[model samples]
Every structure is written in C-alpha cells, then in structure tokens.
Target: MLTPYNLPQDMCMKSHFIFLTLICPGPKDPGKKIDIYLQPLIEEMEELWAIGTPTYDVSTDQMFVMKVAIIWTISDFHAYDMLSGWSTHDLMGCPICMEKSGANWLTFSGKLSYFDCHRKFLPPKH
Candidate 1:
C-alpha cells in the first residue's frame, strides 16, 4: 500500500502521477565526511545514467523510469536493523503530507494499495 502522494495535485480515483523513489541508502547525516566524499562520484554516475537512459522522456508509459539519486555502501547489519524496524505510523494521516486523506493508509502494504487503484489511470490492466 505504499501509495505516494498524487502527482500534479490530482490524486483522486482518477488521474495518474509520477512517482519519485530514492532507492539508495538513506544518508547517515548531511555533514558526515565519508558520505560527502563519496557522494559526488555516485551523483556523477546517476546523472550519466539519467542521460544514458532517459525513461522520463520516453514516449511509452511502460519504459524504465528509475532515476537513482546516488549509491553508497552500508553495513549489512544496520541496513537490516533499519528495514526491520521501519514503520509507516509516522507518515499515515499526517495533515502536513499531501498523501494524507483523513483515514487513508497509502502504504504499499496497506489495505488499499496504489496498485490496487491503478486502473483509475493508465491503460486497462492486462
């Protein structure tokens, strides 16, 4: 149910929106030296990737749209810890967030998934 906010201020039962994903590991801290040092290299690669494969500019909807923000290493144990303890309670029903729809839960694992509602936009499900 990982339903992100609707795109273009049109997140109803209809209308499709772009999804933004930061697949890279969440930064440890903005000012961390190790991160700052390795960041540029990763960012460079990401930019090249975006240019090399511009799915966002593609004519077809099913084209690859992933744009990696960066890449960095993380301790396996810490990564596991973060994922295992991750919870969406903090994000759900927050009025400040665009996804907030009163009692709506927009998580990918939530009862009402964006995929479940995908038919409202895009071509009919195959």
Candidate 2:
C-alpha cells in the first residue's frame, strides 16, 4: 500500500488512507528478480510523473491533474539489497560508505563489525 505523504504524519499511518498498488505472491523471495514484478508499477509511475492523473478536489469542488513522484522508499535491509542491487553483507555492506566503508572482519567471531565506523560521519563537535 502506498502511503500519501501529504497527509498529516499521524494520518499517514492510518490503514484506511493507504492504497494498495500491487501484490506479488510466491513461495520464495523474488530477490534480484523483483525488478520484473516492479516493471509495471515503474511504468505506471513514469506515466504519472509525465502526464499525471485527473483528480477531484472535494473541498474546492474542482478537478486537477495530480502528478506523483516517489520521494523515498521503506524496506528492510534484505529487501533493500534486492531493490537497490546492493548486497547487505560483507565489508562493503554500508551503502553510504560504499568503498570507504569502515568494516573489519573479526578473526574470532568470524563476523563483520562496524564498531566506531560511524564516528567519521558525525559532527566534529559531537
């Protein structure tokens, strides 16, 4: 369901205002192939951005063209990897840092640790 941002922050969280766009049901995760399922939605969004849709304003009792542009997306890390084509594993897992990601592999734990990596991005006074 697409949540309208124009609504008040609290109203955006309400179930009734949310509109269901698409649904893909399957046994396994689509992973990298999610783009296939999203192609139609992408095309529709492109059309909406280019031409817009006719919408009615109840308060003004007037009709207008409503153009929509996706400002952001919300998804878990795993789904994020699938949608963004960025792996959320290993030393370079941090999307913002990319090649400069300050990740280290712990020899004992056999795991990647970010530790104090975020310090560099913080304000100097912080």
Candidate 3:
C-alpha cells in the first residue's frame, strides 16, 4: 500500500507572505527513506531562514530584521514522523507515552492496545 508520491507546496506567513515552495516526491510510509529525502529541503530551508526578515518601524522610521527560529508544517501522521524524525513503532515511538521499555502492549477487551501499560514503570500522565 505504500507508494511514493510527489506534490508541489508552499509555506505562508499569516496567510499573506509566501516563503518557500517546491515540488518533491516521497514514500507514503514514514521511515528512513523519507528522512533521507527530506534532508536537502530541510537544509535549504534552514539556510534561507537564517537570513531573517527585514521590517520597518513606522514610529522610529527605522528598519529592523527579525529572525525566525521555528517553522511549523502540517502533514499526515506518517509524513509528520518522517519530517520530524520520530519512530512509528513501539518503544519511544508512541508520542503520548514516550516509553523506552518496549513492553507497553496490553490486552483490553480482547483487543491489543498500545500506549496502555499493564506494569507500573511510570504513571500515565498522557
């Protein structure tokens, strides 16, 4: 079911300023392959964003530059993990649990459940 797909996209600021845009192909699954594919784009984005943006202050009639430290992107679960370098499997994979023991599976009403611990390694705050 996992196949490679490509689409052109753009990044916008406050629904006005369009910053970056590109067309790229990637696999449907979130794994090492997708991580490899995203590296170049990530590097390019970092380099461009490091330059910051110039802004004009009307009160002082002066220009200042603002640097952005973070970029938020929306994607599907698999794509999100691929872009963010997160694992989709058990043991430090569950975004809510963050468990590293790899023994978090439990049977609940005749069904296997993840992120549900049977043993008390730690309290469940998630």
Candidate 4:
C-alpha cells in the first residue's frame, strides 16, 4: 500500500540535504536495478525526494536549501502509476506549489524541487 513516509531523521529532526542516486523516470515498472548500481536498491526502495523540515547541503562551503530525499522506500509506488490504480494524481502536494501531483513529481535536477512546507519547512531542491 502507498503511504507517506518520513523524509529522514536528519530532515524531520534537523535540516539537511541528503544525497541520493538519480533514478531514471520510467513508463513501466523498472525491475531490480540494485545489481546495476552502487546501492542495493529495489524498484520499491529507490527514489530521490524530500519531505518535512527542510534539509541542507554544502554549497560554496555553506549550507544551502535544507531538504531530505528518497534514499530508500519500504514499498513500491508503481501501483500509483497504474491507470485506475493510484496515479500520481492521488499523491498529496503542498499548497505552496498551488497543486497536487498536479504539478509533477519533484525532479532530480531542478531549482524548485518538491519540498512540502505545510507541516514543516521542506525547501526547494537546488
């Protein structure tokens, strides 16, 4: 089942930008990619996203936008992509974006990355 997972301890408890392997967008279920990467990741446990309380990272030797990311998932979300299953439309979004999955899943490479600041200060990815 698709459920909301915490961003990370460092993120929820503190502010930090966690690094994650960039997963390629797909139209179909991308099976076991762990064997193909440096991390042991599964289709259900691979994504790069941030949630509550903004996390931060070093930029020019200083902290930048605080954020956390998808380092591991406990379940598969491909089910959400299936028609009539649970498309991204079902996913929640921050009013800051003025939309839901309506906008788009946070991009791995972008300035305004998905960072919900509703209950916390999830900041935009840099």
Candidate 5:
C-alpha cells in the first residue's frame, strides 16, 4: 500500500497534505505493466460493486442494491498509460483534449517534459 510520508519540518504542511491524498499505485520499475498485477484488485472491486451496500429496512426486498458510482482519481500518467490505453510519452497523453505535446526542455533540470497545453470544460466524445 502506498502512503504519504512526513516531509521536512521547515516545509509547509497544507499543500503537502493535499498531495498526500493523490498518491496511487502504478508501474514501479521500468518496462513493466501493472495492469495484470492489478487484475485481482479490480476483480475484487467488481465483486464489491456487485455486492453493493447492505441496508436494513422492513419494506426492502433485497439487502444489497447497486447504487455505486466509482470515481477513479489518478495521476495523468496512470490515466494515460493504464485507464485510457495510451502511452504517456506519446501524442495522446491528455484524455480530455487529446492534444499532443512537444519536447519542453527545462532550463533548471535540463530534462525533457511534455505537458498538456490544451484546456477544455469536458472530455472529448469518444
């Protein structure tokens, strides 16, 4: 299980705490896909969804009802690589706008970065 750790004492805790809740599991090592490994968990989640929530009521016929709305809050990389079946480093990284990004070299780190430059109110129609 991935967890957020305490940062330096001098650093502000507000924004850091916000980042803590956004943590998720993904490809730990290079050249390995996590989809197969996550299958069991996904199956379990499906089972749970099938079971639904058990509620007590005299008039109710069934104990479980299918009233679940699964919200998968994940990082952009995971959204691209795992959920959307797209390569993060490719042209279709952003699921919303589907805008292709170019090599954006950072002056400080001297690293190539490709960030989605487009903005949209809603995701594009499939």
Candidate 6:
C-alpha cells in the first residue's frame, strides 16, 4: 500500500506510508502464474473496497472505517506483463498500441523491432 497523493510529496514517499504486503521468494520469475500468488491479496483488497475495516485515527483520536484503493502500481515490464495478463513480447509488445502497434519483424536479426514506433505519441511540435 502507498500513502494518499494529497499528502506532501516528501511525506508520500516516507517509510510509514509504504506497506510491504507480500514477498514471493523465488529463484525464477513467476511469469504468468503470478495471479495464483496474488489471489489472497486480491480478495482482501476487494473486501476492503466493498466493506471497509475499522481503523483508529491517531491524530483525531477517533475510530472510523478505513477503505483502501489501488491507484497505481510500480514494476518492471516483465512483471507488468505477468500482473496485467498482457504479452510483452513480439510485435505487439507495446501495451498501448495492442494490435495497432508500429512494430516490425526484422528478417535479418529475426527479432521484433520497435525503432521510432514511439514517435507517434510525441507532441506535434516536438
């Protein structure tokens, strides 16, 4: 979990707000099987969203229902593919483009090349 974005920039990154929920010990990447490991976390998040948990506020010295929402996630591209169920390989590697990606298969190197494909997203004046 992370701190709310409304907090000061410095406070947002503080250790207090950063909660480490789970850690998967592995010598190899989980790949597409990550959902199996995340099932428990997903269920808990769903419960939190639907029916909040009771929490005590230190500053206010009062009790209230606390609900959690996942606003954003940070991960490498490979892990992103695993979490999102998106294939980050071959010509359609670009998640934004999907089928309309500007990737080209290089016959000489036998690889999918994404050179200059990101130019389409640049500002017109850039």
TM-score of each: 0.21, 0.73, 0.45, 0.20, 0.42, 0.74
- 1-126: candidate 5 lDDT, tens digit per residue: 322233355553446444332233655532335566656666765876777656554466655454343464455575447655667664554554355444366789876566444433337862
lDDT of each: 0.42, 0.86, 0.54, 0.39, 0.51, 0.82
RMSD for each model, in Å, please?
16.4, 3.6, 9.5, 17.1, 11.6, 3.0
Who wins the lDDT comparison? 2
lDDT of 2 by residue, 1-126 (tens): 688886779899799998887676888898888888999989999999999999998878999999989888888889889888888887778787887888888999898998998899899889
lDDT of 2: 0.86
What clash pairs does model 1 have?
1-107, 1-108, 1-109, 1-110, 2-107, 2-108, 3-106
The true-versus-predicted C-alpha distance at residue 16 of model 4, in Å, is 4.0
Q: What's the C-alpha lDDT at position 75 in model 3? A: 69
lDDT of 6 by residue, 1-126 (tens): 545664579898888877777677789877888777889989998999999999888879999998878988988779888888778887777677887888888989998888888788999889
lDDT of 3 at 45: 49
lDDT of 4 by residue, 1-126 (tens): 122234444454332443354454678454444245434443334432333343454344654444334444443444323312333332442223445333334567543434333433345553
Cα lDDT for residue 126, candidate 4: 30
lDDT of 5 at 79: 48
**Cα lDDT for residue 27, candidate 1:** 60
Full ranking by lDDT: 2, 6, 3, 5, 1, 4
Better of 1 and 3 by TM-score: 3
**Residue 9 lDDT in model 5?**
57
Task: Name the candidate, 1 or 5, with the larger TM-score value.
Answer: 5
Which one wins on TM-score? 6
Name the lDDT value of residue 56 in candidate 4.
57
The TM-score obtained by model 6 is 0.74
